[model samples]
Target chain A: MRPLRRLVLAIPALWLFAFFLAPFALVAKISVSRPLVAQPPYEPVFSLADGWQGLWDKLSRLTLDAYALVFSDDLYLDAYLSSLRLAAIATLLTLLIGFPLAHAMTRAPRQWRTALVLLAIAPFWTSFLIRIYAWIMILKDEGLLNHALLSLGLIHAPLSIFATEAAVLIGIVYSYLPFMVLPLYTALEKQDPALLEAAADLGATPLRAFWRITCPLAWPGIFAGLLLVFIPAVGEFVIPDLLGGSDTLMIGRSLWNEFFENRDWPAASAVAIVLLAILIVPLVLHERQQVKERAA
Target chain B: MKRGLQPFHLAVLALGFGFLYVPIALLVLYSFNASRLVTVWGGFSTHWYEALLGNEALLASAFVSLRVALVSSVLATILGTMAAFALVRFGRFSGRTLFAGALYAPLVMPEVIIGLSLLLLFVGLGIDRGFWTIVAGHTTLGLCFVTVVVQARLATFDRSLEEAAMDLGATPLATFRAVTLPLIAPAMLAGCLLAFTLSLDDFVIASFTSGPGSTTLPMRIYAQVRLGVTPEVNAISTLLIGFVGFILLGAAAINRLRKPQGSG
Candidate 1:
């Protein structure tokens, strides 16, 4: 039993260490290395055959120029800022929309609640790229939205929504709405209705009861939903790339350009490292919160 | 206790569902349009769907995605089940915090960082980036999800059944195989399906990890979508949506079937 348990533990631990944790170390190492024109596109490459001394030599030769450049360049800075701003706005928008939807789901007839929840989650099972692509067909200049508006005489010309930040926001909110709604629904569904009834008995208005009782009870879900939406939205590549125009500067797109188009592995790694650094705290805190919740 | 959905709440639900479903409905509608221009309707036709059948590039990439999803989801399920057991059953162990962290981090880690980092690892190890590397990256990504699902099931699992089997003179292995496996089978199946869909739907990780010849369907779709929208793309997108919808419905039906038995 002891040996079997040990084996069970070791297999996944080793796999994650090799594939998940070790890669971060590699990214950190390559971030400080210089870009080369050769294959693999980075220099001061470490080889295991060279042993510790060679590793030490490679380590010593690693430069901070990539980091310096990431900090000094306005492109990287703007991309990072834009990503944060867009992600924050998107998160707020999802919460505004998701909260009411979740509330509605919980308020639904008891038998209908499960079906409603499933309906909310149905979009998530579809291919994310397809969902985003569906938006492109709707939001484009000559798309259905404009055609509908034009026929109604509400607008003289088509709205230029596609390839704009507005399009990206819509794409993000649409794609991730399920993520935000699920958590909020789960949290809301678990609440005791008696509390609201009790508040009403005490002469509390619906709005006041919602603020005092519902909002506080929904805090964990709100936090979880915010992190779920905002974190991924910040590094969202497809939504921004496909929906936002060339003027949209996102760190994820910039990172792709650096590695794929520019062939600058060091610079891309630097960008990744910085992005990771920014996100690690919230990620760790979220994980810790999850652990605590599970344990409790 | 008598409170029900108000008109305001009903309105929100209507708008919310509309926001979610309208685009999908439009995509399906446009796929049937005979027009070369996707937005313009030129009588209903199935020509685009027929065109999709002959597109070798799209079909090849889809085959690649299917193979990757099949293999990687299996790999993720195995690793994830083990990790879930370790976390839930093993309790306190050395490096348990780290183990939990590593297991859950991928859930929220940005895809770009995950992709870039894994690519660097493969390059550093002198391994060629291709189908297998995408499998590895996806397996890593998918396992975290599997762990979360399986862990939720494991947390709520009843251990007394296993203890009863052991008291009846069954070995621990036999008890686990007989009692635990059957009980958790639904959750495991759910985890595998989740992993499979995640791998199938992935674009970013697959993009960074794939080599010249290993383009997945999403990669292919992304490339074509970048150039311009086509009715053919809509046809394929509608097909994928339909396929995934079928799977989710089937899963839901299975869940409904299992619930009565569990409660009984």
Candidate 2:
């Protein structure tokens, strides 16, 4: 069994070594290689002295410029703060909305459980681009919401919604709500009814019982959902770009501009390396939990 | 007696579902609207869908997306399945954690960053940013998902059969080909399909890697959306939703078949 295991494991190791690790190593190497402009498109000009010294200079230079630019530029700083705030808000909203729906599905009259689950996952299965695009139709200046409101005499002017932070918020919340819900539902379904009943019998109010017993028991799932939504939300590109106005200069978009528009490899890699450092802890913890779950 | 759902729970559920479906439902409805302006509903017609079908650029982009998705998804799935087999079957190894982290890095790394870094790598290699560059990008991301799905199936599998086959003098390859492959084939297929969908739907990475002539469907749609959406986008979106809806239904059917009759 052990020897067979060794052989099986070798396959993935070789594959990863060739594709995954090599590509990232290449990214790091290219970040420092002098950008050659005259080759129709930019290419790396690698020289022996240039290789080591260039990496050091590029690394040091990229850190200062990118870091300074990200911090000193009020627009970039504001986009970062707003993005953080929105991702936090969206994750909370998803939990608030998802917990009840997940709870309802698990405890609902038997006939409705599958239907509710299907409904929850249905939107998720659709192309993410379409789902986000769907919001533009509903949230734009003369879009569905404004038209409906105007006809109903709610307001005279169309709401300025299309290119706003609020639209991005709505998009993020919608995109990730299912991610939050699925884990919560899985956790809630496995919960024992007796624990809740016991709390109630001990003279706890229903709310008290839920807060004290259900919440802690469901903490792992809640954390899983948080990691699922929050981490991706931090790095989200499509939602903010599509929904946010010119004011939104998220790190993702910032990185995009650096690579495509500015054609700066070192700067882009610096931003990515920083983002990776920020994301590593949560990702590591989540993977550990997943691995443990499977082992058990 | 236990209480049924409280009014608060009921309201939240209703509001959540309403939020999820209303925007999407409206898009599908408005796609058929005759008005070119998104805000006004001239009348119900399929002119936008007709326009979508008539547009050569849209069709070409869709073709490009399909081709990239098909090639990359197959490659990713094959590599992922092989890796999953190794991970589950192999008891322990030096630097396994490092290897696992590398494999899963693309999953947590923001797509924007991945796209940027990969683009830089390609440019540095003097490689032209085009269809194949996009394929490399998609495959990197797609493999993580494929590995996760296949790993899940492998964990649940009984390993004694493979051991038995090996003990009977059948080589490792023969045992795997005859026994293990048959058992995990469903999961492998599901993972591949999931990879295909993800690659097809990918926008961020594809946008960074692809040059002008190689735009994918999502890339084209994104460009249109950024320029302020028209109903033609709505029409394209409706078609995407329909296509994915069919795929999900098929997935659900397969999932149901995999379970035994007595199990919920």
Work out the TM-score per prediction: 0.97, 0.89
Q: Please, what are the lDDT tens digits per residue for candidate 2 over residues A2-24?
A: 66565556665665665456666
lDDT at B127, model 2: 86
Candidate achieving the largest DockQ? 1
* lDDT tens per residue, model 1, B187-241: 8888888999999999999999999899999999999999888999999998888
**Interface DockQ of candidate 2:** 0.55
Interface RMSD of each: 1.2, 2.5
* Model 1 clashing residue pairs (backbone): none
The C-alpha stretches of model 1 lying farther than 4 A from their native spots are: A51-56, B252-264
DockQ of each: 0.81, 0.55
Q: Which regions in candidate 2 have their CA more than 4 angstroms from the true location?
A: A1-11, A14-19, A22-44, A47-75, B3-11, B161-175, B251-264
Q: TM-score of model 2's chain A, to 2 decimals?
A: 0.85
Worst 10 residues of 1 chain A by lDDT: A287-296
Winning candidate number (TM-score): 1
| lDDT of candidate 1 over A17-104, digit per residue (tens) | 9999999999998999999999878898777787988888888899999999999999999999999999999999999999999999
Q: Across residues B171-240, which tens digit of lDDT does each residue of candidate 2 receive?
A: 9789979888878888888888888888989998898789879999998898898778788998898888
